[model samples]
Target: MTLNQMFDFTPVYIYIVAAVQLFIGFSLSFAIGQILPLRIREFMYYLFSFLFLFIPFLYEIATANVQSGMRSFLFYLALLITIFLFTKESFLKKLSLFFILIFFDGILEIVICSLYWKGICEKLFGLHYTPYINVPNQKVSTILIFFLPVALAEIAFNFLFPLLWKRYIRFIHLTTFVEMILLPVLCTNGFLIFLPELFGMTGWILLFFILFVLSLLFLHAVTQIPVI
Candidate 1:
């Protein structure tokens, strides 16, 4: 076994996945957004905000360690709760956002696995990859290159096609729910379930409020701008 594999890299790998969540979730910087106006058409507005503002700095402070994963994982739960609470977006936009979220949240996990295959594992971050955390087995080699780009494609789909398509929101959300639940299983140690733990007793409630506020901001902005 390699040094990292022998040492148990799962938790840190989880952290890397978490970092990607923050990145894709936020998709930050207002000025840069002008260049890619279509990005805001989907929930990618949030995704881009999270990614642009915090990821690189976060990458610098944290390790390709498990704590990093916890940061990513914990932060995203906060974000999801925010979304669930706020905004009057149609089910179709919500479903489209769900599709984009597939990669935005999962990429952290996928990237760590890719780095490992490339023999540069430690540089990747997240919950299961810390010195004390667990190492996920299985090399998702093919998934690495394609995953993010596909996420980008999903974003593009929502961006370019603002009108709702033939599919229904219920169907897509249910499918997304399956994928979300499945990720922790296929990933090691199943730590994502513990998200609210990091936030304390009222975490869910707080998340709801934040979502409410953000949704208002998004709606207000969308109504004012010519885009939506």
Candidate 2:
């Protein structure tokens, strides 16, 4: 009828959207782990491990409902159990392993957020009203307080660990160097400042492309994985 009526501003809408996100994360991880090869999984785990570092802080912003929070936490915990049970990653690559663990936790959260954007989330769960809760997407204070630590930790974990994973250091160095160079520019351009926008997805697409290529090169230089 009118713009106001068309908007669907009901609390029921929030509940439904949040519920769908929780379902998609764990389900997709399972599907992916099942389909890909072992080596591919190793590469993906490394790639996704770094990608995941930003997720928890993002999710903490997205779903402010009480029911959403509790169930989502449990779902992530379960996703970890499933992946660990199926993984072939060695225990020794300590830095890589550390990233893998944290990334595993974060991916579940990211997948949930992605679903929220896709509009499928509302269909699975519906209409519940609750007290007012603020979920401003670009939560600058909260992001700085929680995610600043994560960003610093990424420096230590992603950039510094190469000293020990000496073989992969060159590639990790290259990877982190690129990230170091691009991160400030990205922040300035308003992804971090604005939040929830896919601003310049190309940069990230290229960045990850470079990281994966470098990883392949590094793996090739050190070990003789077939490149066919």
Candidate 3:
């Protein structure tokens, strides 16, 4: 195949998704500001947030590998590390929370994207084509297929997470919050990795929607947990 055939031009929707990622990145920083004890200037906080979000995309472009799994993982890691640099929190505490949140988010991203690609994008949108037409690995194809849907989820979570943080902000302890988030992450990852194919397309759709609802519920429930 020719070089043209080897490249998969991203769709317009995916470009929109990139813009959403920027917003989500900003939202993450904003959320951290609300929770972290640091007192950064508003303007600088927004600037660093945008930097954390946009740099990964630049890295992807520089490498010409949009389906990079490690890059996606590293993006969040780097974002948290940068945040760590600015915060006054104990380094171990900050770093531990960073890893926890990143792991939770990564697992959540994978599950949601898998369900969307296997169910909605394929069955509804008729996007039957491989994720990376020219790319060879099935894992890469899987990552690429789910990237946009995950972006959409990230955008929604960006807004919703902060809202939960605001409402339940006084109630939940930090340790409890992390534990609450971990439950769904573990369950969803297990289902997707081991028993994913058990769900037919319709089943996947239902599962995805159920998980979406549960995510909101989980956030609300965590915030309502009283600090003993």
Candidate 4:
């Protein structure tokens, strides 16, 4: 097949792969959640929360499609706001935890992208690559290389954060939670979405640096919030 023809099918293939992954991930997580003890089941709820909220953005970032990435981020933001409004739980505390999850997810995205772009593809398959340009040459390998790390990272963070929160931060205050969610949304829109449109890859790198620093601040603030 000609290069253009091969590239043309990339999006369709990506969507199919992503759909399958999501189905399997959700099914397994739900099944496991069903069997766990009640306290541990709450942690499983945290896992479900990340899967529901962040997977769209995860797939978009893996594909390196900025337009779709923007849409996914906006979709995630909308879902978060909706959950905050409708849920019976303490909205502020839950929203704060969700944003913290987002910050870590963003950090993971940066790491995955860095590893992929810098040397992973070259070392693994001896091909210089971006998500789009050279995919047709190594389609399955490329997709698996990107997808596996992301999936594994999601599982790791989903498990780890709940434990950390239970141990270190049992609750967050209303004011701190407000700042936690608000600033990240503003910074994410600017760095991940808008600036990338204006400045291209430079803007993408800036997202990593700025969000990493912001995440540190987020962690610090969460730790400092007086535990109720």
* Residue 216 CA displacement from its true place in model 3, Å: 32
Question: Would you list the C-alpha lDDT of every candidate in the order shown?
Answer: 0.41, 0.38, 0.56, 0.53
Worst 10 residues of 2 by lDDT: 187-196
Indicate which candidate wins on lDDT.
3
Scored by lDDT, model 3 comes in at: 0.56
Candidate 4, position 148, lDDT: 62
Candidate 4: segments with Cα more than 4 A from true spot: 1-10, 20-70, 116-119, 133-138, 169-228
lDDT of 4 by residue, 1-228 (tens): 753365564454455445534543343333223322233345546465445645554545466342344544544554464344434456555565555555655666567767865666678777664554235344565666656666666556555665655566546464566456655655653335654765799977976777787687677667766663
> Each candidate's root-mean-square deviation in Å?
12.8, 16.3, 10.6, 8.1
Per-residue C-alpha lDDT of model 3 across residues 25-132, encoded as one tens digit per residue: 666666666555664676776677677778766655455444444345445655675577566677755644553544545666777867877788789866764645
In terms of TM-score, which candidate is stronger, 2 or 4?
A: 4
Ranking by TM-score: 3, 4, 1, 2
Q: How far off is residue 78 in model 1, in Å?
A: 3.5
TM-score for all models, in order of appearance: 0.32, 0.27, 0.55, 0.51
Candidate 2 structure lDDT: 0.38
- Candidate 1 Cα outliers beyond 4 Å, as residue runs: 1-21, 27-69, 90-100, 103-228
True lDDT of residue 116, candidate 3:
78
Please give the distance, in angstroms, between residue 98's alpha carbon in candidate 2 and its true position after superposition: 8.4
Strongest candidate by TM-score: 3
Candidate 1 achieves a global lDDT of 0.41
- Candidate 2: misplaced stretches above 4 Å? 1-11, 27-72, 91-228
